[model samples]
Target: MFTEISADEHDRQLELHGPLTAAVRRLVEAGISTGADSETIRQAQLAVEAIAETLEQQRHDGPRTMRHAVTGRPVVLADPVIGVRNAIAPPLTVQHTESGRCWTEFTLGAPYEGPPGRVHGGICALVLDHILGEVASDGLRQPRFTGTLTLKYLRATPLGRLRAEAWVERIEGIKAFARGQILDDEGVTVEAEGIFIAPAWAREAG
Candidate 1:
């Protein structure tokens, strides 16, 4: 179910995978937006397919959780919104606080747009969901899954550098109540609140 590795090993793994992820991230945006001719697009497509085939041959057996032995927390290498090793992630770096708050500042480009020049509402939801979940889990010391999430879009979120924050408003026995928001340069764009539930296994461990 999981792989336990030393801190150095994890660092080495990142070194091996980070460059590829970064390259693919650029490739995705370029592939979507390039005004290249058919010939040029054909060449690029061939190159990308070759690269994907090579990597696919070396893929891991299946989904495997990699946990850090020293930190006692699973390494976030493949999270869709924040995974450094995942091409789809904007790779937002979340800063967690002792005060039960978490925030991240990140940039979104043309790929994340929905309405003209605006960030997709769903993308905003994804970012806030992960941020609030992090707050509820307390950095995974207490495993909590999102039970319910509600969002209010005050205005359109522009696609560029943005900041989002979430914090625990209160907690019941097994449910944690949290609220969060996303902001652009001007002000807050989306407001979110969620309930997260700790499963029986987590409670037993606690």
Candidate 2:
């Protein structure tokens, strides 16, 4: 489930595609926030269509789980949460991972808004799920899938800079237990706990 690429080749991939992905992220935000007139919006649509077509001219048969040569860590370019190439991701990235813990600092903008200025509840869950799941998986050394995840939204999460972290509480046989929380400047806004399990295939492989 991982595609390993050499350091030089991975850098090449980023150099070629990183800028385009950044532009796409900006475009996505613009699409949600832009107040362009109808004609301008229509023209923009055509231009975006052209860009998509250009990129589609050459394509991978399908997306796959991958790793960056720089980090040598798993990367899912199309992942909805932390995927480097996915425009829709609030684009969370782990800033720290060690001692059975993982953490990240990120901002959720207009595109992720809910309840006027609050971050979407579902989005918060998504963020926690990814972190908790990753921690429970032990950075994929012993990969596991989410068996259950529970979140408690302690307060309305704002649409701006925030921090999230998760850590492995314990592991029992094929299951790993993890806990995580989300915080803003004021402090904890969400708390989460999850159970991650090694699937039958993964258990057998191990």
Highest lDDT: give the candidate number: 1
| C-alpha RMSD for every candidate | 1.5, 1.8
Residue 103's lDDT within candidate 1 is 91
Residue pairs in steric clash, candidate 1? none
Cα lDDT computed for each candidate against the true fold: 0.89, 0.85
For candidate 2, write residues 22-111 as lDDT tens digits. 789889889999999999999999999998999889987744577655666776767888766777888777755446589989999888
- Checking candidate 2 for backbone clashes, the offending pairs are none
TM-score of each: 0.94, 0.92
lDDT of 2: 0.85
* lDDT: worst 10-residue window of model 1: 58-67
What is the total number of backbone clashes in candidate 1? 0
